[model samples]
Target: MPTETPRPMRRQILTFAVVGVINTATYYGFYLLFLIALPYLGAHVLAFLLSMTGSFFLNARFTYRTRPTWRKFLLFPLTNAANFLITTAGVYVIVGVLHHGSRFAPLGASMAAIPVTFVVSRWIMVPKAGTA
Candidate 1:
């Protein structure tokens, strides 16, 4: 007989996906709002930071079901740094190099970073048996 997948893992993945959608929307909204006032890169950075803040809470409460902590909050940016770097570079390349529209470049670039972000975020949010 074939082995079955774990329920907890499945739930976590589903929750993470849901949270990702919400985060993306939140980020895009902020990006659009900021685009009117700032350049595309500036808008992307500000929007990413704001959405990341909201993502911490949502991922903690909904995806990982972990308790929020000052430590985790502070460390959360580390998880996002990879995503930030990748997406920022991607946006730059897509817009500056390829001459894509600034408004939509971030949305296109960010998709590539999502899986890495999810994995890093899960590692950060979920506590080990002895660590929690």
Candidate 2:
């Protein structure tokens, strides 16, 4: 009988952070492109949704090394519920309330939500112990 090695939390965190960087770059590129045709909030929402779709796959494949399933995919957005709320508020505060530009608002907004996102995403993407 073979025993599986335990996965390291530190390694998983590092992988998640790398995936985040890639997702952020992808999101930023889309946000900038969308800004050309839409308002900041509109562009933000569209870009956010699109990048989130990509993020799901990236996290599944690399960060967690889990198979992507419809159940998980459906629940994936819940992982970002806090992230979305936090970043949206942060962006609003920075860009609307503080008079900053849309271009950099999301980058700043995204920082605070990382820890929460990691926790929630892991819960949502990975099956519970003794199950699945």
List TM-scores for all candidates, in order: 0.92, 0.91
Q: Candidate 1 on 10-107: residue-level lDDT in tens?
A: 89889989998999999999999999999999999999999999999999999899999999999899879989999999999999999988988888
TM-score between model 2 and native: 0.91
Q: Looking at model 2, which ten-residue stretch has the lowest summed lDDT?
A: 123-132
Best by lDDT: 2
Each model's lDDT:
0.89, 0.91
Clash-forming residue pairs, model 1:
none
User: What RMSD does model 1 have?
Assistant: 2.2
Off by over 4 Å in 1: 1-4, 129-132
